[model samples]
Target: MQFRPTLWPTLITIPALVVLVMFGWWQVQRLQWKTELIQELEIRGAGPAIPLLVDARISAEDLMFRRVTVTGHYMHEAEMHLLNRVRDGIPGINVFTPLVRANGGGALLVNRGWVPIDWPGTSIEDHDVEPVIVEVTGVVRIPDPPGWLTPGNEPEKNAWYFIDLAGMSAAAGVLPFTDYYVFATGEKNLAGEPVPWLAPDPNEWRVDLPNNHLTYAITWFSLAGVLFIIYVIYHTRRRGPDDG
Candidate 1:
């Protein structure tokens, strides 16, 4: 029971096979990159806190997971509430307030951390620090934009689902802020922690980040192997009338 595969079908498969292999290779590269990033986060997050120089030319990559101290006063008037955030099985939103640097620099957006969803019933000022001059020790974090499947931010409505510092700052008139935001690892001031709020800890977030690139790479390679087997079998199992 032999059937012949035409030359055209075999030729077409050549490019198709190459593309599949290329995809597998790309995923393999991503696996290595993700592994190194995960390792760096664990190592840096455990180190002692350092003074953050907002005026310095530090790249976000250099600042990831590193603990730093920020001295500034909260700008309660321009706070942004990041919706769709939850902690410890409780639903709530995280508060992001702009900070005016004490050392005579531009403002920075500090993720002071989460609070109850009903916070609007009261006022963000209620969580504000008493002394204008306050010190916050936290981990440096680069905010991730809304995911592809996530809804887009509505800047005009002041409703946000994820962190987009540039848009949020500009809309609230808090521009010229830091490119990266700080995840408050400790209490923002002497006022103590906010009620029903959980501070953003990098260690907890790191544990949940997915690292399945290696698995995806193997899947692509396996598909390529299956395709190759079909191609070889089709060409081998062929007979002509002369064989009859």
Candidate 2:
């Protein structure tokens, strides 16, 4: 079989093929990186809780999802609410309060847990007349960057769609706050008593990291294959008429 390729088709097809293949390869690399991250997080979650060093310079990757103990007094006046959180098909918000470390380390935001949207008090002070100093065990959490579609947080109104450490700190007047926050472990407070809100069990609260790179990679490669087949057929038909 004679293969006569036209100049126009060859030029167009070669660059298009190169671009498609490159995209597919990049997705494969992303798949591997994501898999390793999930595995490391699981191992950290299973270990014993360690004391959080407020002054220590820890990378976000190293601190994320690690169970740690922090002793502090809850700053009820500085509490903030994260909107649009749901549990058991009910809409609610996650309550975040700054914990002023007992050791004078620094103020660390603590995600106390989820509360009903209609829950009367925005801060713990509304419920407790006096402040309480306690030690709590919880899981460290790093805030994810807001997506393009996510609405901007309103600090003046105390409305939050996502976690913004810097913004929250400034709004609450708690400067020099820790970069990461902690999710309290049980539905009850440190005293083993029931609280108004629900807390997540760190052991059961597995990370829901999405991994769709494999599917994306297949689509790009398929498109490249289809393009190659069309190019060959077009050239072959043109040669057939000349031969006859």
lDDT of each: 0.74, 0.78
State the lDDT of candidate 2 residue by residue for 1-244, as single tens digits: 4567999999999999999999989888888888888888988988999988855667766889888898867777777889988777978888888888888887888888777787766544565534456677888888889989889999887899999999999988877677788887742245554443333422245677788989988999999999999988777743355685
lDDT by residue (56-156, candidate 1, tens digit) is: 77888788778888787777667677887776777777777787878777787888767767656325455554435667788888877567888888877
Model 2 poorest ten-residue lDDT run: 195-204
Cα RMSDs, all models? 4.0, 3.1
Local distance difference test, candidate 1: 0.74
Note the clash tally of each candidate. Answer: 0, 0
Query: What TM-score does each of the candidates earn?
Result: 0.79, 0.85
Which candidate should be chosen as best, given lDDT against the real structure? 2
Alpha carbon deviation, residue 143, candidate 2 (Å)? 1.0
